[model samples]
Target chain A: MLSVNRINTYRIPFTFEYYRPRTLREALEILRSVEGAKVVAGGTDLVVDMKFRRVEPKALVDVSKLEELRYVRLVEDYVEIGSAVTLQELVESEVVRARLPLLWEAVNSMASWQVRNIATIGGNICNASPAADTAPPLLAYGAKLLLTSLDGVREVGIGEFFVGPKRSIIRPDEVLQAIRVPVHPAGYGWSFRKVSRTSFDIAKISVAVLLKVDGGRIRDPRIALGAVAPTPVRARSTERAIESLSLEEALEVGPRFVEGDIAPIDDVRSTAWYRREVAKVLLRDSLRTAYERSLNPGWVHEG
Target chain B: MRVRLRVNGSWVEVDVEPHETLLNVLRDRLRIRSVKYGCGIGECGSCTVLLNGRPVTSCLVLAAGLDGTSIETADYLAKTELGTRIVNALLLEGAIQCGYCIPGFLVTIYAALKSGMIRRGDSTEIARAISGNICRCTGYINIVKAVRRVVAELVAIGAD
Candidate 1:
């Protein structure tokens, strides 16, 4: 028999309420009425944190049953992903793999298959961990977050949605409804690299690079880094430095520029010095790989 | 909270704490002791069960969330002909060992087999499908052998 820990009884702070809302309107009403209500999608991250007493909300509004927030569609120039969609769904989605391969790559490299089955993209973004796997790719893809509350709907850039570690601009009453990823035209190349102790370890440092090249000169470039800052950040300095550089010159200068932009901390996963060094390495490698794949489209593999 | 679920083709209703894990509810409330609790977390696959035809870690699944869902435990394996063949092969091949992890292994393999995830006559596919499950005693040699035997039987019976 497994050793059962003695159950401890604490005085009820108050009888917290649990509400299961099946529709978007019902969910919004519950979130608007409850003072400290939380929206539970897959409960992969929330329930674990609650069990450890890290988070205690007055009410939990289960939104896993909301079918409206569980789809992936390509509309106009963007691929809109519903917030309640599971990581597993994203990883296995044929449309996601076809249109947004980098997003598929990042999601596949996250927690094991079982966790992916229950972890939702919205929960991942809402949890707002600095090491979130989906953020860098989404940011690189120029994704827009769609948030909804009883008041109305609002959209925010993925980069601006995250304010700090374990924090976002989302209000207590607002729930993330969808992620809109702008579709890059053909010939745009992308790469995502996550360095960790093991394949399953939370990213020590992750880098995403997107490049579009025309006639061997950079047409457009975007770079994002995670786990090396308070929030996943676009490396504007590094991106600007390589904006006009040739593919060869960009390869040489990208790492040096990236090394100067990040502010990493020494944590249990890695030291500041190591993270910075790996950040440079990953940035250079991902840039080179993305550039090569962009110029040679046939080399890119579909996930 | 009182939750009702279809377990192994039978309706089971039990009252459980809102926070109680599905693993706890299965073993404690339903007396489905076959689902062992190893590592209480999802890391160890000893508490695996089929939820709506997919193998999921029952430890991380809350009982409240499983209301009205179809759950399959190891005890149900004997009801199907293919399941009985696999179970018989396991016994004949001496894959039992400590037996604590057998139930989860059985359920995981059953789901994999029924889903056509592990095609007949493919031992590598069978091994990869059940790689999530950890068996401390068997060292997996006999377990793989038993699975291979079942694969062969499945091929001969045209049950692919």
Candidate 2:
């Protein structure tokens, strides 16, 4: 039996220098100077990797102390969220809940309240898990990410952020600064549905839909699915197909197009066959709900 | 690295390795028994603590970064009026099985109820609020019943 005291020293068997930068500029400088350095925020994901020796770093740049990157504010037509803002803070923010239901619902369906308190949205995005619950919603919302480096800031749409499973285009010297979710026009309806082994577990399959119903026809639909491909992807082919059909016809024929756009594989959480079938059902249901909310403008006030 | 933390209203400073977790610092150095190591990952809430008044898994938090933060554990909370009421309710409802998960449950419950997320007679919300902790022995029914009972009394007396 292991002594209770062993849990402390058993963590991270390797030694590494830790840097907690006080300012964003200092953080960037450390990232630029330190070789084999990794940025940690919340430390919920990176620390776990270190514990299992999945990743080993020579220096860890702590971005949590950079206060400039911890905020959620409404500026003009979008809600800008700092990368260091915890998932719990997003759940508690009025701007996120009121204006970004697609993003809001996904955050709520994630790990327990305890993990959410320490997990950052930026970490979720940069980790680039295929089953990232926040990705589908952010993709559906057409959100934008601001990556900061000493060179300056560059904007990348969320859809273009991920390159592969657990991979992204984030440069070594840059940090994800803020996420901008557009305060969509009032006529849109949003739905985010995730299915996991348990409510707190990683997503087996998830879908987010942002639909507009105008005069009984679906227009410019944005559908995103997670845990179906190497990366969370927007179903553009499905959207183009749905937009050309009436709401009733699309509800009947739309889900099939999702199969063409995604290639789910069998994994520990679920089988590819099961994911394909269940994803169709979720897409249909989400479309129905989103259609209803689009017609009933009163649903906009539901916070 | 040296980290300074305020635990249960008392400030203490300790030397921590860069990889040392807050869970290690509290349990080994501070001898705070409220936290336990059920799982090194955040899946199990047995290592839960209140960081700046919000419930978080201490095992996932690096101690070196928490230089001047405040922490609250079940060790300090078990003495308060609300904590006493929660303990009595758990006992009254026969929620203890092995009693190993009780401290983690108590800490999660205290933070949720104190924050007003769990309301009177709302069993579903109560279960969701305390879902962070996993109890391998006692099923959650009696535990949910205990929280419901605590909320009812707190409401009746107009206390939170």
Candidate 3:
């Protein structure tokens, strides 16, 4: 039984030291040395959870103060987005807006502008929610997660990062350092669609598509869906179905392929049946829109 | 834990628990009740305050984490000339009903006006700027009227 004396309505029971390290090495060392410590980047997610009694960490290592981790750099063949970079920063960045427009689109459709100002890209991915807005677009872009620990740093494919809903392959002592996305060729066109109960609410079903097309024949296609399964998933079957088809034919077959790819569950916001149906509809619409834009980039400005 | 911050243009030193929120520190310790605790969560903008000149929900912000940051609450605006004009307009327009949400609305609009995001005499821009704050009283008609009146006054002063 939970102890009544141990619980406080206004504060947490346990008191631990709070450390705001100036450097990444100092922060990582504190995280490794302190037991049950949580790394706080932006604190948009962790602080809310802590206030609501959802998560209680023994110590909080504030990583937002580390200026070195807050950067967006374009390397040789990939764009490296530091984990501490805020969603608003990512959305407004000329590099991200010009190079990765799909990510910008996804970031724009996320929570309100005020929330996005403080919510970090790393927090969204680290939270590991299936409905995370940034995941589907990043996965579709073939991004890789950079994880660092006291031992060493390693990269993992974004698709394989999530083990389940609200769970990831990241170790307790490891932190997400950065996300590296391979630069796409100039001809790639992308689109992101989200179906939510309200414009600002969480998504019921979302879809992202990145395709390289020449005269309506698909050269390469990538599709990812969110809020339909326990984790964001690539609809490879849907990609295969529309690989050799024209834009119009692909739209017709896209819904059928998506219907078979996702397994949704009934939740408070929506039922499994409604989610599946919307997933199919969004997948079809997103593919059609992406294909049309790829054929004629000028269509984006037309109404 | 002890956290010292600049509040309402004044440096305040307060000792708060590790789990204390900025809202708690502002109201309980500093005795600035203007920032109300309606929801005790980020959903309600009642606890909104300006952290480094950007509007953020204070209930979600940790007081310990806000060290070395500047915070501005609705009360700080009462000292400004533009703020005085807007308050008078709000009172004249009967925009205050229960007065629970007035502080949040005032702080948000003050920041928006000071930022020059909404030009003087632009009602639509003012409305869009304050869209994030929800007010349950006066049906928002009088609130819009109050903002427009203040904006018109500011524009007239600029002409002077």
Enumerate residue pairs that collide in model 1.
Answer: none
Residues B1-160, candidate 1, lDDT per residue (tens digit)? 7788998898988886666778878888889888888866565678888888778778777677667899888888756887798899899999998888888888877877787767754666776567668898988888888888887888887765
TM-score (chain B) of candidate 2: 0.96
Best by lDDT: 2
User: What does candidate 2's lDDT look like per residue over A202-297, in tens digits?
Assistant: 999999999888788898899999999999999988999999578789888888899998989998999999999988989999998888888876
Docking quality level of the chain pair in candidate 3:
acceptable
Model 2 lDDT, full chain set: 0.88
Sort every candidate by DockQ, greatest first. 2, 3, 1
Write model 2 residue lDDT over B113-149, tens digit each, in one string. 9887786558778878988899988879999999989
Alpha-carbon RMSD, each predicted model: 3.7, 2.4, 3.8
Candidate 2 iRMS, in Å?
1.7
Clashes of each: 0, 0, 0
Q: Give the top-scoring candidate (TM-score).
A: 2
lDDT, candidate 3, A131-248, per-residue tens: 9999999999889999998898999999999989889999888889899988654677788999987555678999999887876587678999999999988998988998878878
> Which of the two candidates, 2 or 3, achieves a greater TM-score against the reference?
2
Candidate 1 docking quality: incorrect, acceptable, medium or high? acceptable
